[model samples]
Target: MKETPLCLTVGHLLPYSMTDFNTTDFTNPSTFILLGIPGLEAAHVWISIPFCTMYAIAILGNSTILFIVKKEPSLHGPMYYFLCMLAVTDLGLSTSMLPKMLSIFWFNSKEISFSACLTQMYFIHCFSVIQSGILVAMALDRYVAICHPLRYSTILTNPIVAKISLAVVLRGGMLALRYPILARQWPYCKTNIIPQPYCTHIAMVNLACADTRISSYYGLFVLFCVMGLDVIFITMSYIQILRVIFSLPTKDARLKTFWTCGSHLFVILAFYIPGLFISLLSRFGQNVLLHFHVLIANVYLLMPLVLNPIIYGVRTKQIRDRLFRLFTHEGA
Candidate 1:
């Protein structure tokens, strides 16, 4: 029988097999292998159990948030509108990455086409930026309600909210486009094994045989522009909110004002803390284990998705009451 080379391609878009590996020629692989948490391959099944559970709860919780907000006429305000955007963003973020991650863990299906991988990277990062923007909008909502209560409606009318939502989507989509575009241009002559389960900008850039300083700097620029500015705006709004609460001249009023902002504060911390950690670690954690980095990256993405709905559902009186009524068969 004639010998055949162990190589494959899908219209020139799949990875060449091991038989085609060449040390002398630098070329991009059409497929990349995802090593689901290197060094913890033996524990992948165990690790996936929690990840799968979180993804499931995220789906149910965010879905419930969307459904309840839509069905309740009282929740038709700007705050709830932003919350719906948040829930939708969370759903998108989780859906984009978790299914493939679970597949890698459960079925050992690690091969991902380069194009598919870049697309995944783009959506994951884009949704993350959108979620950040939504959080800022939520903070602004709380700020207006608490600080400028008389003009809250005037300032955040339905049209304004719609415009803000449009801006958020456009900003996230445009900013995140650079990642996959830059990644696509780089030559992936290095081994096509991505250390992380999902294709992150850093992970994909690491696989590039070319210089990546531009990508690295642009990532920092995004970090500053998105997370940094968002955090500053949220903090400033909350600071003003605090001033208003403290000047309310009654303990009950102050407490009530504080209570209203509690869920948003918690959600902000939940999203940003892990995110900042992951961002810093990705760029600077040379001493950290590969598996630890991978694990934390996955957690950073999943934690906000899982916790946002639970926080809002439990802390916001209307959401909590509606959720209770949902389970207990009470009136709308």
Candidate 2:
């Protein structure tokens, strides 16, 4: 009888004995180990400090935005409603990863059950997709307000905004729900080690013994159909918005309109660019460094969460004024 050595490779499962591997159950993998930031395991403690800071800011900043929006009657408009939706999605996105990430870094606890990994993957991707949808909804709101001021009120009523938020959640949730289901059915007899800090559909799928072309293609399809289309429509809306802004006779009006959109545009770019880069790199950049992929993925998750509230606070006068008033009142 010959014994086989278990080899752990980057972005792959451990090779098991042929006889034992053939008989191993795929659906019932006792545990999956998460290898956080391959080749930099020694620096994980130092890495966790900045990540923890960003997580704290994400929670506190987004919470403040939600509090101001809910308390300020002046913010009860379509734009702010969309802003609130964005804050909630950012919160969900950060919370989904931070706890597990900290545990891996601080406690060196990397073992995740098969079912738990699937659930985490589902929410991380779902919230991400929903955030993109929220950005699109905000773009449409801006389009109506700037392109057709008179009809803005009637077109984007409270009910309509509510419906839009509901649709965003449903669209993202329904599509992302398929990832975990599909990944679960595949036989994961190879290795149970994920190289990234957290579980992702792509990372998990890559671990399976079965061919995962279908899962890969389906994930790409949803990414383009949902997020790609949202980016396209957002661009179109901004084009029309720019046309409307330039046509205004008064420079003050143009500036005001631009100011209104500044924070959202910043947030949109913050959310989409890193996301697109990571998606592209993961799919096509086989030669790219694994650490680069890990870094960008973390950026994509943390950037929007940390920057959005700050952008809104500094760029939007209403939120800023409310924040100032709240603080001043507390001081007095």
Candidate 3:
């Protein structure tokens, strides 16, 4: 069977198929229709219940963490300061996408304006990068506290923490700015249906009819430079932390030191493992199921946000005490 030519023009001799194909809208659409989890469309309502619940937990938990950290003078140290940064980043990360996702699932409102999609992409990736950097900062705080106990306070002072926070913000914003800029330059002559619920750099790039190699390469570059370096720095910091922990005099001392670092390590794993898995799956797992990819993507975005506050609250003794006292006092 020979394929019909998409555009054939010999005056009135042109076939109906060619005429229709040629007249088919090739211009960029002003808005995109997001098909939330392609194969699981019927289950979107059920899927949204958990997603909405996770978003609510993330918002409440992160907000509580921020409030407690702000009010507690005892938590004014570098570790708690970094925790506050993480809380804010988690809030931004979940808030960037969850509302639109819920709207898509519940009301079948999947249309997202072109500019709005780019903005969403920027915020989502920007906050994610900032969160990764903050995790590294937190790991460094632990390393200093454990490895250089006497100098910990001096090393990670308030001014230094502020500077690190500034650097994290600048790096995340600058790196993420390129995504929206590059995406905006691409002519989206293809279909405007983004497969995922949220707009991502690659997703927008994929909609372009032009050669997308540059965007693809750049996305990979940013991913490896930011997330890759972050993972390495975090790993090295924890390795040193572990070495110091093991070298401590007593078993109880070692346990205490490890316990202090345990929450951060769990948070780091929760943030990175699913993220890296999703990245790898998107890049290489072509044969993998589509619904699974969408599901993991949603999890990658929400799980750490929802779990971070819980993990820190339960694991950090001071936060637990503060929270308990706050609740009990309110009840009284």
Candidate 4:
């Protein structure tokens, strides 16, 4: 149907809209739907249940690890310290977005004020950077232990680990300040609707009206720099570890060394391969594939946060023995 002049003239009368309007009212979508796993309908309710349950599990799981480590005097070394940091980053990361996302899905609280949206955006970037930094820290710890055992304790002692952790978090927090600033630069005349569960930088860029070259460039730049540096650091650490392991007196010693790094290695590969997959798919895939991409995105983002504690707690002899004794005593 042709748009009549009378209809055009009527739209001019509405305050929320004007002839100057260059974009549609999708700035506030009728529904801020998730491009989630694609079966549609009230299936959204099922999705909310799983996500909320995962949120609770992630929080409790990481908290349990932190609590366990803090309670045990023997678990105060550099390895445990890095594990503690990983748990923290994971919990903070999930807590940063899951609650609000679940609320949006279930309670219909879709209208996030721009300020709140910006706040989420900031923490998301900050926590992600912190997580990457923690991985690098862990890789460095492994490097010291396997490469230079005598100086390992001296190099990764309390003060050094604390300094490293502090530097990573502060640096990430500083870099994250740019996101909200860049976010506000956009007029948002197009649509306020975000496609993903959280306020992602690229998602927000898609909603922008002004030139988004800067935001896109920065987002991709930071993404590559952080993830790329992490991959490089991890690879170098393992290479050194392999060299050191082979130099050891026996195959048994090498096996032990491999076992020591096994959990950390698993978590690293789990997080990265899927992240690369998601980044690739997000760039090229859609519908079912895109839906799958987002699901993997959440899992990869949460993997270290959820898996760190469990991996360390179960794999570390001291932590496991303490928990075993605790349970054994309770049974008595």
Candidate 5:
């Protein structure tokens, strides 16, 4: 029997099998090279022991949020319900990219299978979109609780909230899944080196030799259309919330509102502001601001996973009490 050397594409938007690339010339792919950090120390600097620590703590923290909500039935309402969903999304976000990123950085495991890349892209974008929507849903919950307190329960019942959660997750998932399929349809005639840490859709789009007009349009459409729309709705919801808070005529109420919204605003700014800068830089600056771009990217991606648990959970007394109970409960 004849023997053929195994071929695999490392890390990515679409899972391209070498067998699939047989008809296509991938060896001499065009322009952009991944330019992985040239040295092991360099990769180590980007990802160190702390990276794994942060990643593990992030997963555990977010998982604890879901566990607390489930263990206590008093948390059966819309707020905690949405919180569990947020925790689930946070876990998805962290596990999607962090483990792979840290593996590459720490153990010199830079090589990632093509399918793994696609899967990463799908989950990262899906959870990110859902996170954005969940923030919007939370804002709505606040709005109803404060502005229309009388009708809050009547309006935000379990069935209604659950349906909204389902819709948000489904919509985000569908939006993200589209790209992997789209990428597979196209040929990878360009350089396959992904300069960034993970298989981002934008980076993948940058590698294509075919006319990227559609991909570019779709990227901008998702950003300006979907992401933009989510940001706008969040802003609008908060604006109405502020108006209600101001009208309350009590300092304590206003202060409480500020505290409640503060963590979310922090998360939003952590993810969006830098993300916006990176997006514009990629499109216009030709990756000139690479260092800042990468640093800001970590802020956008990992901060949410770890910070959400600390900011939201620690701030809420119920969560603290629940944690105390979880650990202090009678055990065998």
Candidate 6:
């Protein structure tokens, strides 16, 4: 107030400005930068080692399952066919992130074009939804096999499994299609630097300059409608299966039925629990640390890919026996 120089006053206020001086028009930003694990940039090299190992295992393991299912005619049933679809989804999910993630972690190459980022987001979500559907399908298969053994073949024939697989892909693709389009239409006057390791619907939505409530609500709707329904159905199927198993006269029959579902139950729990956690955290736990969100999200994606094949290999006698025979024949 004492006749301070205009330049001096402006200089003093510059540091306090809340507006992003570099914020561009919504249409102006051609690219977004991914910051891998906000405060752990220095340790990216070490972090990438395990991620690379997981990616390798996911690819090799899933591919081996596909090969075994294809070459072994005895494995050509509905359950194995669904497992093959799961393998494909796992492959898509892992490949969608790992190459870009490794590049960011190892080379510090984080700049992604708007279109490419949206594409990655699409596949990531699509595969995720597809995985949920596959799990539900697997549960239905088990229910039929255990609860209605006489009609199992009639209920889930090869053609019917193929149809279910196609429907799963289509359903997931349709739901995922909207997310990227909504994000793309939003104006990004805020910073283009996404704090997470990869592009996700919520992560990209949070960066929008306009009100993001619609996108947020729609995402939640899709989660509940798709993944939530899958979980409910899977749970119901297992309950019925258990009821039927218990009704069996002999202990051996009941034990055999439970053993058959062991691998699938493990895979379902492994996939859904982390996914539900991530979904809840993204929506409600804004105060949670950024790295923790990143870690959990990565775990949701990587853990199933690595664990699914291992669980199936160890728990399913057919897969285990075939793997042993294949290895032994190779050695011979």
Off by more than 4 A, model 4: 1-23, 26-41, 283-290
Query: Local error of candidate 5 at 329, Å?
Result: 4.5
Residue-wise C-alpha lDDT for candidate 5, range 1-332, written one tens digit per residue: 22112111111111122221123357433333322332233656545565677788888888888888888878788988887888888888888877767666766576665666677777877888888888888878877877788999999998999899999999888888887777666667645666556766766665556675676566667766777788898888888888888887799978987777676677677667766665555456542444444544655577667878887677777888989876787552
Q: Taking the tens digit of each residue's C-alpha lDDT, what string does model 3 give over 63-142?
A: 99999988889988899999999999989988899999999899999999999999998998799888888998998898
Candidates in order: C-alpha RMSD to true structure: 7.5, 5.5, 8.1, 8.4, 7.5, 8.5
Please provide, for model 2 over 224-291, each residue's C-alpha lDDT reduced to its tens digit, 9 standing for 90 to 100: 67677988999999999999999999999999988788988999988877665665565566556656
TM-score-superior candidate, 2 or 5 = 2
For candidate 6, write residues 222-323 as lDDT tens digits: 766767788899999999999999998999988987999999999998887776666566556656665776666677778898999989988888888899
Candidate 3 weakest ten by summed lDDT: 7-16
Residue 78, model 6: lDDT of 92
Best by TM-score: 3
- Residue 57 lDDT, candidate 1, scale 0-100: 96
Q: Supply the TM-score for candidate 5.
A: 0.83
Error of 6 at 99 (Å): 0.6
The estimated TM-scores of all candidates read: 0.89, 0.90, 0.91, 0.86, 0.83, 0.90
Q: Write down the lDDT that model 4 would get.
A: 0.69
Stretches off by above 4 angstroms in model 6 are 1-27, 279-288
Candidate 5, lDDT over the whole model: 0.68
lDDT of each: 0.81, 0.81, 0.80, 0.69, 0.68, 0.80
Clashing pairs in 6: none
Two-way lDDT contest, 4 vs 5, winner: 4
lDDT of 3 at 204: 67
- Which of candidates 3 and 5 is the stronger one according to lDDT? 3
Show model 3 residue runs off by greater than 4 Å.
1-24, 279-285
